[model samples]
Target: MTSNAPDSVERADVVIVGSRCAGTAAAVPLVRAGHKVVVLDKARFPADTLSTHVLVPNGVSELKKMGALDRILALNPARSTHLRITDGDMVVCERYKPFDGIDYGICVPRNLQDECLVETAREAGADIREKCSVESVVWRGGRAVGVVYRDPDGEEREIHAKLVIGADGRRSRVAAEVDSWTPYRGSKNGRGFAFRYMDDPKAGTSQHEEMGVYRAERTVGLTLPSTPEGRVLAVWMCPAEDVSGFRMDPEAAWQQKLDGDPVMADRLAGAQNMGKVRSTADLSSYYRRSSGPGWALAGDAGHFKDPVTGNGMRDALKHGRLLGEAAAPRLHDPERLDAALAVWERGRDLDTLSTYHWGNRESRPDPVSDLVREVLRTFAGQEGPDLSDTFNRARPIEAIVSPTHLVKGLVAALRRPGADRKAIVKQALGELPLEWHGRRNRLLDGFRSTRPTKTERPDWTVGNAPGPPSYRPAADPAPVGADVPAVAA
Candidate 1:
């Protein structure tokens, strides 16, 4: 390891690869510790990412922790609280009113979001490099030492640091260099695909009806509560095996299928193409066999569950923070670096498996969907809360995105003012189960994972899917395991 003499000629205190949510999240804490940090990535900021574009309240809180909430709120894309969706029968369920947290997270384009944090890291004193791709891991006695990357100009450089962090996306360059990955699991654990679009907003509606199938049977799409009007944002997930056809005529196929969609068809009528549809076909899940030996993995490097949960970005943030905290003290306790990572892995593993299990099980829920309808049936005309701070808390997205169980799902469609609880009722058809608390997960327990292991996805994992219009934590330290799951992997 290099000397930590404040200004050592040999290296940085930390080296992070990739500058997405995970990398930036880790950079925040590291910079605070005064570590010389270098964040390397192949893509520059302001990238147009294919994400659903809805930030959960918890994600907003994380931004606040990183000192980004103020700027974000000022640039709010659009805040939505309830979701109005029509069944195959053309029966529409009103929005789900969040009984607890912000009805919806402010929706900003992914490109803008990436730029926000990357700039934050630089302001906090991190060396930021774009168009830089890592080549391999530098090691000393099987322990990490630094990283080797190719600069944008195609020149190779060696960066030696005490702690090397690999926050690259799903196809992590660092993970490939390290021989410590476990399979993503079964058949479902293979490649997945996704693509994005800008959308046209309906006159009076703001909170995007980010929609998923009752049990995630197949297609996934959502109309985000965002800007650059006349463009309707959406995404569709498919297996990698079928990507060949989709890539051949991405825009055409996307337009055709979406225009053929019952709900999205009308929404897209006024919206034109804001950008070309892009796809990330290799999206899948995998975990490091170990997160030790002086090296650590964050974000996609550690796990890659399907976006069916809308938690990848959130997982990256939470795990990145945890990894950063564990790595921070290492500048002073290099000998215990391995131990610190072990703890991070244990906690993160449980968290990832829990989310994966539920996400996969929730793939197609016709039975439980009925139960959810029963729940939304409970909060038809009640105003949950009315404070901006109350809506920005880091609560679980379950209450906001419940499956076939559309009660709390619609009733809890928490968003900013414009449409009150009564208006939300007039707009939709169902609710997420209230459970004296929030959405129910028991019906989805078994289906979470194809393997159905206890370790992967647990039962009643997180309690009461937080209420709408109150995203702020009623308590502190961020809900432990309650509302954080929607954002976590």
Candidate 2:
């Protein structure tokens, strides 16, 4: 694993750093296309990490496309078909309908989920190198062509590739080395998360599966079933100031908080704490520069939004695959590849910005305003868009919160008998400010001209590849160092 001789230099068509959802998802497409792909991860398999870990229907669909959804469900995850949200006095429950024969969200633990995706990539002919740390990006004349990594033995080796991908998490070393700056950084809310796992066999069944969100005063709690081990993740996202006290004695405090909510408390009345409590603070959302000369960023490495919306997994998995498909056709030419990646980056921004703003509002440490409460009351069975669509990102934000929709909703509220005109006025003022803030950013960003002028077919890169990527279906589908046709329209 030395670089002293040309023959000794480990080579691949694409070298992917980080083997979680993003890196593995990206590698699958290239490997299927018969490209030589090497995926490197610093961590060993079946390791745990902090994640909301709820896969809404949108996320499930992406896994389905990769043929991994069934495998995930085989782990006996609770299949949720409805979401029940309790916002102060108003209660709303909406059922989930099937999307392309798939319904329900699965909450697989990150450790098990990451293993499934990495194994999927291996099945498709990608070489997965675990416990390998990427020390630095290998740059040549301003373009990244490879990386310097340390294997598990702590021996340094150089890997050269036609393209290098940074699928690492939000704190991406690849992005840092490339100076990939953030164009927009969203506001940070004072909210922090404290989570714990429990054994709850009676959480719900598939036919009656449920996800519960309760917002009382300034505190919010989420309870969802996760993994085959009969574990459910109960999370409390409260003001940052309250976290230290909870951290002192998490189980006792968590139980106390749950006791305040009769419904959540009842569901967990007999459940036993399975592990120690974990917490995270200072959650800020932002989008980073996604692509440059020879390297492109995917997943959290490229862009990350708040986890409040639970769309991180979908974004990471879907966009990683899209990026790989986009680069497949133009991998040999840095110019075309960069252009395609630019297109992918733009699409990613457009798709996630609305959710990003929504997450900011959710993550805000301030008490849930009456105005926001009123809005949530409307997102129900009788009014507003389907809760699943709004929360799961099945539809764009424009569908739910357009100017026309807002005006109509306001008028409807004002017409109600015994309406508090003063409260209505305050609601409008409070909500519109954040809406305007998001609008201003979007407007400014729209005017910024970026990307190459030349346009090649971009749609084909989105899972529209010519055929099955690999020559075979199982492991080692292609011979070592196989080269397939360049993806083209």
Candidate 3:
């Protein structure tokens, strides 16, 4: 598409790039608050991604808050769950309950999920334009004033707005449009390696079902919910550069590793090749800040993690909600925009930072992979399924470091061989270090932050626009395009 014609001067309260989870979620909350929102995306809908397709419970909750939980459930993506951690011949499932009741997350194809959400934002009155690439961010007096984008018709156009948001994914063009963002350089998001297909029938499988992260000592495989014919599965990793072989022949690379490992190979049996056997270099990464003057970033644009935690979409949803709530007060007062975003940053920074580091930890297994698997399996029944979160959060490390608090743990270890009780505890404590304890959730003397969930009137809709944006680009040329300093306030 071209640029926005010189004749047209578009107006919006908020303009967002990327229309998946973060952009859509941000639009909904702002639309309810009566903001005129425009969501621009460089790609069309129903796009495929290197995703495991699982929505963690927290991811589900945020979608629920955005009024998408029921709709998502109705889509009937496979609902299978529980992590099944296998080490050699032993299989153990450890459940990590951040809250209650939900032991597993939901699984849906990335294409279907993104499409559903873009449509939802449309219903809520967001001017969603697909296949439109943003050229640059327009600035006024050194502050973000609007955006200059290449429209679907291959024309250039500018959409004036009170604020511009980088809802774009990890490698965001909007983020590049900002000055402070320059110092951040490139994106912190890692590369993602994944492949999916309908499960081959010959694996001697049970009824069609979706399983959450199934981790072995060296690799991880995930199954999405069952499709009409079968289930979708993907084996992915976020390795630190050295495991660079995946960028070449991913299929061969994956095969070599999976085939060498008996457990992972078992997970791949009867796996039919479906779509593109590719990798996404722009997996999620941690960002320095969330907002600046007249702009804020959400979802992968803000922060993302390796797929090991299976929380990218979940983080997007939660962070988007927070962004919406932050922008709410600013929508009316205008003067409070910066302040509001600062509050939102304060509310989310710690949690996301903690999650990213944890995700990095899970990207690759440690030296004692076999022993770790044994310990997890031995305690499987008592814990939930899937040790991705367990491993990522290093819950086992916490248990060992504080052995005095874990009754029966020594006995449980004693039942299994190659175990040294006190020595193991000492090793764990030494590895954990003392500084991290400061980040642990502490017993507050008073109360938690009382942030309201509903930042605006739910009855409002951003999708109420007369029609979707089909901005025609101009034949002529026009060039374009935040300090994230210490939170916005």
Candidate 4:
């Protein structure tokens, strides 16, 4: 194939970069709506990516809505129906509440999941160009119009489109080209992560279909049933500062970490390790501006949170579809398209802000304090809504464990016989600073603006758009992780 001349640029209604979850998802809706959709990715099908790979019920719903769930099911991935969380001697176990008729989580490997999504988009009429690298966005009159890319054959080509969507990962090339890579709000992730697969024929079977999460002094571990049947994904999360040591001897470090935790050790007993451990230390969370005049960012390209919550895949699918739906109807009318994109961005922020902050707090590399443990015990004993609902997005996280519950748990701990009253009081007092910071940040977020300012551009034209609405936390809200005892469900 020869490079196309600049004057012979190809065209499309929507050109999307990155063919994984977000990009493929966005393509389905647009192409089905009768638009010419082009999706590009630098990798071929069945390639792997760094991910925890757990999809809660809401994520399953998203897959079904996109018409891809059946394909995923055919892969024989394990269905996780229950969740178990352990901290010290406190244990909370519960079945996942049904959401949109979905009652289970799926832990499909990224290779299968992304390839399934790409196929789904292709079947829906999107032209998917694998192994195509996007070099830059095409600019005309201050708004994006298309992309300049290198095809797998080493031929350069141009695609001019009414809208360009960036569904690339955290370090999105499209976002960088559009100047939307800078996050407006962010927090340093406190933990590092590592995982590997194991042979577990009993996984996803009777009495073993539950996802296990174990929290120790400064670490967290997870056991999730995964694809190809009879296999499980084992994970370990520790302080970010400790990730370097694992790089030297990942096998030994992973084994030592698992052996140190009796719960993990028990779960992995008799299981055979499948390969070398995979690890990542760059888990910082943030929110970036999602859209502008002619370009939009979806998935981790726009917003990312710590993997501790295991909600990234769900958000990626849901928001990517939402963005496509929002833009499809107004593609011919640039003004309406821009307005719709802005609205979608605002809604995305409002929907995910709390979880973003909660993920940050949960990723902290501190031991679970006694006060928090007591609250967890109380919450486990008397729970109104199923904690699983939080993961399903059926209920707000704050509602799972309210401020009243926190106070009650504290008082109950103080009343227990032989309790260390002084230490309990001291622990509660020590949490005041964190609580104050959470409250203050919530307040400030409510008043802050998200609208981009207008400026003259020498390279292109500009458009006017409305600013996003402020985010207000629920009244008398508890600090991010203090009330949410279950790290993940």
Report the number of the highest-TM-score candidate: 4
lDDT of candidate 4 over 269-317, digit per residue (tens): 8897576688888877766667777889999998888888888988999
Compared with the true structure, the alpha-carbon lDDT of candidate 3 equals 0.58
> Which window of ten consecutive residues has the lowest lDDT sum in model 2?
454-463
lDDT tens string, model 1, 1-489?
222223433477899999988998898898898888999988977786556565655566667777666666666456555444333432333333332343555567788778888888788888999999888888776567888778989987778888888898656677656643433232132334545655554635543433323212244444555654334456655434445656888767776556546566665556644666666654434444435566777987766666656667877887888788777876656556666665676667655554554455433322234333333344334334221121222233343334544444454443423435564564343321222111223333221222323223222211121111112222222221322221111
Q: List TM-scores for all candidates, in order.
A: 0.69, 0.85, 0.75, 0.87
lDDT of 3 by residue, 267-327 (tens): 5566675555556544433443456567777887755566766667877877787788779
For model 3, the stretches where C-alpha displacement exceeds 4 angstroms are: 1-8, 94-104, 180-192, 200-217, 226-229, 238-251, 273-275, 280-284, 368-371, 374-379, 383-430, 434-489
lDDT winner: 4
- Once model 4 is optimally superposed onto the true structure by TM-score, how far is the C-alpha of residue 46 displaced, in angstroms? 1.2
What stretches of model 2 exceed 4 Å from their correct place? 1-7, 181-184, 204-208, 259-263, 382-385, 403-420, 439-444, 447-489
Cα lDDT of model 2 by residue, 1-489, tens digit: 123336787888999999988898889889878799999999999777778687888788888877687677778776767787887676778776566677778888898888888878888899999999998888776667898989999999889988889998877777666655332233444577888778875754542366778887677888887776467788888876778868798868777777777766766677775667888764556556676677888998876666778888899998998888888877888777766766677677777777877777677666665555666666655523276676677776656666765776677667767878788888788777677656554444452223211111111111111211212212211112232223234
Scanning candidate 3 in windows of ten residues, the lowest lDDT window is 473-482
User: What lDDT would candidate 4 get against the real structure?
Assistant: 0.77
CA shift of 392, model 4, Å: 2.2
- Please report, in order, the local distance difference test score of every candidate based on alpha carbons: 0.57, 0.71, 0.58, 0.77
Q: Judged by TM-score relative to the true structure, which candidate is superior, 3 or 4?
A: 4
